[model samples]
Target: MSPEQRLASLLAMHGENELVEFKEAKNQYAFDKLGKYFSALSNEANLCGQSRAWLVLGVKDDRTVVGTQFRTKTADLMSLKKEIADKVTHRLTFIAIHEVAHPQGRVLLFEIPAAPQGLPIAWDGHYFGRDGESLGALNIEEIERIRLQNRADDWSAVTLPEASLEDLDPEAIEQARKSFARKNPRLIAELEAWDTPTFLNKAKLTINGKITRTAILLLGLPEAAHWLNPSSATISWILKDRDGLERDYQHFSCPLLLSVDEVFHKIRNLKYRYLVEGTLFPEEVEQYDPYIIREALNNAIAHQDYTLGGKISLVEFEDDRLCFSNEGGFIPGSIESVIHADAPETRYRNRFLADAMVNLNMIDTIGSGIRKMFQIQRNRFFPLPEYRLNERRVQVTIIGRVLDQAYARKLAACPELSLDDIMLLDRVQKQQPITDQQARHLKKRGLIEGRKPNYYISAELAEQSGDKAEYIRYRAFDDQHYKQMIIECLEKFKTARRSDIDRLLLDKLPDVLDANQKHHKVKNLMQSLKNQGLIENDGRIWRLSNP
Candidate 1:
């Protein structure tokens, strides 16, 4: 199908929105301007509840089929796509680009994908918004709304009125004290002086010495979980084979502080050996860090969305990845924001309950749980923890070993790379979209190459990538060079027939037209090119506007 036809089909499929536009490209199309458009359209699309927005080339402001001659060479055009993708956060890239041929000429089509949940796509470190037809900076209120929209539940603070001190297991309470003492050594002295009720109260696990849902979750006996009401509290730990098939599963009851140890004991923590260059001996490592496991289990117990009637799940896959999925959306902000700020926000789903867990030292009050997870993984040379926040839930997956040697080496080689940089690169390795700024940053660091069809590699990674020859074959074209070519061609072909124009320009153009559609193709190309100020038409004659 032609680019124009495909765009029409896409528009019909998506329906009308303030975000999508069919522009004639009549004025010079600046890359920076396009970047602003991306931010505006993406944000507008999200606010308007649309999945995507389009910037269709070769159409006039009035939706007229002016036909485009915007001769964006295939490689040069791809650079535009890469430029946008690399700059955005999460490495968000276009879904696809389509070129269409019409009787008047050729058209270029850009399909921009929607931003991920809770994460708005920004251009060059700032977000853009559309106020009616005019694009401007995104307002703070809009940003807050986007952030808040994803959160559905906060399970930590829910009151269990019927739950009392008796609901907690005595064994669990003693275990909690030991764990708390281990985490807060300074508290050990004070902890010994306080009675169980006072300690529990101080820990925020109980209100006025009465049991709370936090107490039940952290130290409640398995049988007492039912007494908490509305939902039963449980944690299921599963051991899976290398293929991700479950081999064994065990369920732990609430008053989870003590039961966490029972779950931890099920996983084997053997010594692992790694080759250290220039050394005769291999480096010995633990299979999984004890602190990480404790943190993961405690985090699950503390942040679970019990209102969903879902139990916190810890799944250990054979592929050496540990996944913990709780029943709630992530708190409204980037994981980086939470870590870097090192302060809990005022708004929390379960403020009171989280306070109790913090006092007990089961969870950090500063909202550094995720940051700590990243630090631990980095220290262990493991892939960073991956946090997936959807509309309904938050899933965190931590890989125990290096999945890509090249990626690991790249990270190892660059000790100066910040945690945020590492997180962005990890997303790239996982084939997730990133912003244009992020793409440029990675390119600058020599960790990745190409523009749109980009790939990450250490020097060793390029060798292991297997398709080295193919990577070299798809070299991106220089935009300035291609633009110059378009100008020169239009100058030389003054008054050239449509057929002649197509013959001169077809090969280098974007892949938006069929081999047989040369007549319609030339018409669209001249139209778009003229609009972009690359060429000017004097009745039947065409020439470069400035040159």
Candidate 2:
């Protein structure tokens, strides 16, 4: 193991309260705490002159090491790392996780690196400091000191002084007014009495009758878009085949609110059909929900990182998934926070621009856009919208229809499943790790089987899919299982030949394996099993090495 990993393992073995510190996993842990811990550990590592710090999981207070069996697979752990990097300052990441096998059980060792010089991490706009053994809020002076280290202006709110009313597109403005009326029917009378300038002001498009960059972005004429220096004020919609090769591309000019419909018109929303649950009759649904498309487009216009000089992009794939990505990261901590909570804590990258969008009815003010997207996907039996955040951008993917009917039907049969449950199941289908809670739900429904590191379609889901044996064979060889199988084969056969093992186990392998590639798989399995200390292999044969 590396030094950082060794340090973390040593800390965990000693006990959290005795070596490291312990704090309640509340809001910061509950909401923003991960970011805080990342920053605090990063800074503390610098102060102590240590290469790394430890964030040991499954421990309690008073130096007591109450081992936590809160098992998270490798992929789940990586997801956590990605989430923290996406939200934290400067995209700092954990060095490594060392899983130490202590006498008590397994202890997870999180190796956090020191903060970079002149840069401190901020979690959801707040900074934290370690006070003795407890974590307390950072003081104003320290916070200010950290803030001064990074100086970047908000680009979306910048005023376009040279642009005038003549630069605004009349057609786009008229369409914006109509959309506003549609969103708020009660404001129709008041809206009709107002003139163009008054409407623009009421819509929050313009500030005190002066044209802003937001206004030009949403409704600027082609020439006006050209006048906005540095970045092009256009939204590009691209349709790609399965290979990610662009088949078609189109650009739309501002005001984006009015042009959103025009952009939608460019997409081919054909009808998709699937069989009914009890009957063979096909049920047809719209390829994509109109409201979801509008919400996605509006969100892109509202939250875009215009300062980065990147255009908003909408990419459609042959798999019936639409990916909407902008040049900004999610201001809220996560997609889960947006869906679970009824009202989100007000936070925005482009405050003025977002407010303008709210007034124009382009986006919802109550922060229900994401929740609504989830609800729509659920109602349609389609995959829930997937949100991915990288260093400087957020991507939202909305799948149009159920690609796998067997999986969809199995999911639909379990009506008691929560959004979280469905999300976990989706992850499972995507070969991602399901949380402990999700694993329990799936087991309770008899839809999934296996313990940690061993999971597959349960007998119930397999029966529903009309292929019990096939499903079992596919999910039979989890990492641990495969390793164990190799050991068992060697013990039984004394000195098992590679071909002999392949003949015995290849038939029971998962569907992901091709019939033609069975020999290659056997070779790979032997290598993996040998590496895990479960078996030993010479050039020609293999035998059991460890119990």
Best candidate, lDDT-wise? 2
Position 79, candidate 2: lDDT: 53
Quote each prediction's TM-score: 0.57, 0.69
Q: Model 2 residue 517 lDDT?
A: 58
Q: Which candidate number maximizes TM-score? A: 2
Residue 185's lDDT within candidate 2 is 89
- Tens digits of lDDT, candidate 1, 302-333: 56666778888889887777888887666443
Q: Where is the poorest 10-residue window by lDDT in model 1?
A: 467-476
Candidate 1 regions exceeding 4 Å error are 1-162, 179-193, 339-342, 431-436, 458-547
Model 1 whole-model lDDT (C-alpha atoms)? 0.67
Residue-by-residue lDDT tens digits, candidate 2, 1-547: 5534564455555444212554322112342655677677766665555556777654445434445454345445445656776676655667655554545545555667665434565665666667656676766665565445334454566777777899998988888798788877899999999999999888878878888888888878877877667776778999999999989999877667667877899888889998767688998999899999998888887788776888888999988889998987766546764554435334567777887777677777676778888878877778878889876898989888895565677666666666766777777666566555456556876767766635666777768656555466656456567656767766776788877888777876765445665567677877887777767867786787753
Candidate 1 backbone overlaps, count: 43
- The clash count of every prediction, one per candidate, is 43, 12
